[model samples]
Target: MEMIFIFIIYFVIGLLASTLGAVAGLGGGIIIKPVLDLFGHFDLPTIGVLSAATVLAMATMSLVKFRKKGHKTDKVVSSILAVGSIFGGILGKVIFNIIAISLNMPTVTGFIQSATLALLLTLIFIYFIKKDKLTSFVFKNRLIILTIGFILGFLSAFLGIGGGPLNVTILILLFSMNAKNAAINSIYIIFFSQLSALILIALTTGFSSYDLSMLVYMIIGGIIGGFIGSSIVIKMSNTQVEKIFNISILVIIFVNIYNIVNLLY
Candidate 1:
């Protein structure tokens, strides 16, 4: 009975997180970790593992829905980003293990992650607010986009996020993609990054003993939630989608700030 109850909780949380993630182009990890942390049942590394699994499921389902709806995404761009993210994900996993597991300095790592997140979100928020004045800049070079993908993947893995927010924002700023298309493409890019990070962590740490029953439940919920969320996103206008994305970033910024302060004192 107790086990069943826990599974139910995880499923519900996954549903909510993935729904928001699908709409906002986030990987749901940003939502999931804070909720799970409140349970006090897992450590940071374990939370990272579980969240990555959930994000993979969410991204996969969201991408399928987006493609089914005939949402056009640049296959060439997606391929380039995926290739870059693959390598970046591996590097991020190595760093995460070194700082959070090997060194056993989770608090310090949390401070670092939250601080960086605060900075990233602040800049994104400012850009969204002042985008009109900013001259549109589109990178003609595929190499530059690939490099940006690598950096986004590294940050996503290191911070245990789905890399959606960062991916979407960069796509809009660098490629001048509208919000709707950026959100769809972001999910595709996130699929590669989160999957690579999961594999790397599994290979290095060996998940032989960590019971993933909860993760399985979360994945199930993520699939269902992603479908529904994508449907809603498909109906919304680009402007509305951009607003939601920016609002989510502001919320996440506050969350990161709180985490940073807690870690410091």
Candidate 2:
């Protein structure tokens, strides 16, 4: 009964997180990582892995829905970025294991992750408020795009956040992509990155060692959330999507701040 109850809770979390993730392009891990931390039911590494799994499912569904709806994406740019993200994901997973498992310091690792996320989100928020005044670049160079994707993948995988926030920001600022196109491409990039990370997890720890049942529940919720979120975003205007994205970013930053404080004292 307790296990069943826990599954239900996880499903709810996944549903909410993925819904928001799909809408805002934050890939749901931005919410999942911090929320799971607050629950205090699992270790930091466990939370990261679980979050990665859920994000993978959410990304997959979001992409499928976007395709079915005939939403257009920057395929060339997204492809280059995704290729870089795959490699970055592997590196991020390796670093995570080194800290959480090898060093046996999950608490310190958690603090680092939250602090990093908070810092990144804060920077992104600042950029957004001053976006109009600031310059936006459009790089045609493939190498630059790859570098950006690598950085985004490393950050998302390392912090256990989805590629949405960072990916969207980069797309908008670096490529001058509109919010809608950026969101769609964000899903594409995160999918490959998260898949690489999951594969690493399978090779290193083996999926069986972890709580597969918990993931099953979360995945179901993520699928539902992905479908609903895709439905909502396709119909909405760019301005509407940005409004939600702005609000969600602020909320996530605060959550990370709170988490950082909790980890410290």
| Highest-TM-score candidate | 2
Q: What global local distance difference test value does model 1 have?
A: 0.82
**RMSD, one per candidate, in order:** 1.7, 1.3
Which candidate leads the pack in lDDT? 2
Name the regions of candidate 2 deviating beyond 4 angstroms: none
Local accuracy by lDDT, each model:
0.82, 0.86
TM-score of 2: 0.96
TM-score of each: 0.93, 0.96
- Model 2 lDDT tens row, 18-53: 998898788898899999988888887778778888
Query: Candidate 1: deviation at residue 79, Å?
Result: 1.7
Q: Put down candidate 1 lDDT per residue, 207-241, tens digits, no spaces.
A: 86565768888998888888888888999999999
Ten residues in sequence with the least summed lDDT for candidate 1: 33-42
